[model samples]
Target: MLDFTSIVMTIAPELWLALAGLVGVLLGAVFGDRFNSFSFKFGALSLFGAAALAAIHLSGGESFGGLVRTNTFVNFAKVISFVLAGVALFMSESFLKRHETIRYEYALLTIFASLGMGIILSAADLMTLYMGIETLSLSSYVMAAFHRDSARSSEAGLKYFVLGALASGMLLYGASLVYGFSGTTSFAGIAASDMSNGTLFGMVLMIVGMAFKISAAPMHVWTPDVYEGAPTSVVAFFASAPKMASTVMFANVLFVVFGAAYDQWQLIIAIIAGLSMIIGALGALVQTNIKRLLGYSSIANVGYGLVAVAAGQEAGAAALLTFITIYAVTSLGLFAGVLAMRRRGGMVESISELGGLARTKPVLAVMLSVLIFSIAGLPPFGGFFGKYEVLRAGLDAGLMPLAILVVIASVISLGYYLRLIKIMWFDEPTERFENTDAPVMGTVVLSAVVAGIVFMVFISELGTGGWATYAASGLLR
Candidate 1:
């Protein structure tokens, strides 16, 4: 049992960030757009602060009378998501300034979104979970339409809001049913209750809602439109932080709260996994827009993560975290590469525009190819190992067909990934890309380096895999 002071201290990072966001709102109101640069840096540092605190205060316990929980698993999620959120803010500062849409509120909203993710990772009860989900959804909807002048931006905002609202409703309905059936809103209590028909139905609904939030297939209709329509910087952020949080949430709700009913939910997850992979694989093939292609790629990657989730047990959780870490870095790099595609002070989005990239920007072309190969699950990169772990986990859990499907999907995805590589290396170069922003370049280089290095430690006997296994044990126990 934790004392009040100790409980508050455990959650200090979130408190610190919330206070920072409040201060940022006041800063923006007083200084207006002139404060944009400082605000971005301010927000980024604040996110890093939260991440550092989480890493430093890494321990296990429940707080707020079991509303919020913190442990190695939750802290690991918090640390990674907060770091990604900070990078997003840093990247946003330059991109927003260039487009003359820079606002202090942008950074503040991001800070708030990061806070929501923290709440989610720490959530020990259904009510806290719902609050965290809504907080993230509301902030993200606004950020998607930050450029209110553009029709595409407005459309993106509207689509996300409408779909997101529906998803939220489903989740709440499920939560209410769960409370009614279990006689409590606490995850621990719900997990301890008998698995009745009403509870199972409610769990399925909650899973559907969560799938929509994560853009897993059948529920993933809005992803491409939102990706293509939103600002590249915003999409870059979306691809990393929110995706990580949602995946972790999916695993948490499944393995921690509903572990006893694994036999019941496992099939549902496996079916969704197959559908997501098929849709993601085929969907990207015809996408002419780079961002849209990436949207589909994200859907496919989620499928890969879910394969691990369906595996169950400690290995499943470890593989899921490992895959997500590599995926997040790969995505940041790919989107940062997108951020580099500009000519004559205007952004470019078409896949064909990448023609002759090797001759024009050799370094970027290579970096992108490396990222593409990584995502395609090619050899020696971190992504390949990430895929390997999940597949192995699936097979070990007697999910032979899902493992086979995983291999087939990887093969199918190579079609588009290789197409991009050929275009960059073989085709005649398109117009020269304008000088890339420093932050954008930094993200690309940093992500690529991490992707390159992660594979080494990821496979080592005492490295990333071990850390993930330990974290998984905490959640499982």
Candidate 2:
């Protein structure tokens, strides 16, 4: 017999977010133009409520016969996704309004995306994982092209949809192969089945599918184009929340279901990691567009997280979680700063446009510099510790060569990051960026910056706080 209470509790966060999305859509339909102001508040509140509910269930357990599970690890990732989504939505309103593209549907899609991420983080079976990925991808496709009038926006949507379809097909084919061989789609069932070559092939396909979602290399070709074409506010959410959920999902599949077959997948993941770091680092060096540069930077960051995943131990999982948390916070902060880069003409995308920003908008310049420094893995910033954690995990796992690659990637990444900083501080003034009166964007950026600084100062305490350890142990145990 099924436990009704357990099922309800287990799915409460997803239900709440789904309900919030429905309400947002209904508000848009009912009030028409009057819904814009309320939509931001509604979306933020809904995501916060869902995050709170997930946090309350942190001591999680299996429900729906283990199709879904809630535990500290799952809840932690979900809360981060929800909170980041909410912040993105809240910060996006002014930018969207200024672009004349504000709509309640934006909030609705964001809510739905958060719901999808929540589903992915809590999913305990292959079928459930597929459902979550589809939900997230479908919503993301629409969100990416929210500006229907712009050809670039349309291109982004079409590219994402086509690529996303290919990924989904691959995922489904791999799932079918696993089910055919094991006669089940559950993680436990697959784990207990014989590790045949076909089963291993299926797992590889699944990993490749997921790699596309996380923007890992070889599969990351779509990322720069999409990031460059999409609206910056939407890209902010894209760079942070979805990546978090996908990375956690990838970690879960590898560490939980495929634990016994680590030898088969480890080399593949290592290659992906090394390639992502190299491609992301080297590619970003020549990019003039800020968004494209950050997009490549994101690919590199994903590589760093994957290094931890390839460690295949509890420490690796913990380090992965920690690195992603830092990455999300810093990335959001960077994008928030990007959203603030406006002028009488329109929003700026070129790195040259930021030249001499220090003379006009000293505060924004400083914040951007801090974020860039952190991303470059500079000391006394959260990003440095984030890289250290992953490198430490890689070295501990005896993956010395991988650790060295990470260092090389970091050094290569510094070139572009410092260039951005130099443009802001040392170069001649190109144009005056208009001052943004967007309080929500300011608040989000400030919070992320402060958190990044604090996390750096308390790195040891935060990493050892048992959150990652507990979450990792639950999945790996």
TM-score of each candidate structure, all chains considered together: 0.98, 0.98
Candidate 1 Cα misplacement greater than 4 A, ranges: 461-465
Tens-place lDDT per residue, model 2, 1-477, is 877878878888998988888877777888998998789889988988988988887777788877987677778888888888888888888888888999888898898888889888888899899999999999999999999999999999999999989988998898888888878888888888898888888998999899999999999999999999999889999998898989988988888778889988989999999999999999999999999999999999999999999998666988988889889888888888888878888988999998888898887888788888887889988888889999999998889989999999999999999999899999999777787757645854674565457777777755645567766666743
lDDT of 1 by residue, 1-477 (tens): 549877876787789899999999888889887788899899999999999989887776668988988787777778888999899889888888888998888999999999989888888899999999998999999999999999999999999999999999999999999899999999999999998999999999999999998899889999999999999999998999989988988899998888889999999999999999989999999999999999999999999999999999665888888888889888988999999878874887888888988888888888888888888988888888889889988988999989998998999999999988888889886687888888888888888777866664455531245767766767854
- Which run of 10 residues does model 1 get worst, by summed lDDT? 456-465
Q: What's the CA error at residue 319 for candidate 2, in Å?
A: 0.2
Count the clashes in each prediction: 1, 1
Q: What is the lDDT of residue 19 in candidate 2?
A: 80
For candidate 1, list the clashing residue pairs, or say none. 356-429
On lDDT, the candidate that comes out on top is 1
True lDDT of residue 434, candidate 1: 87
List lDDT for all candidates, in order. 0.88, 0.87
Determine the C-alpha RMSD for candidate 2 after optimal superposition of all C-alphas. 1.3
Minimum summed lDDT over a 10-residue window in model 2 is located at 443-452
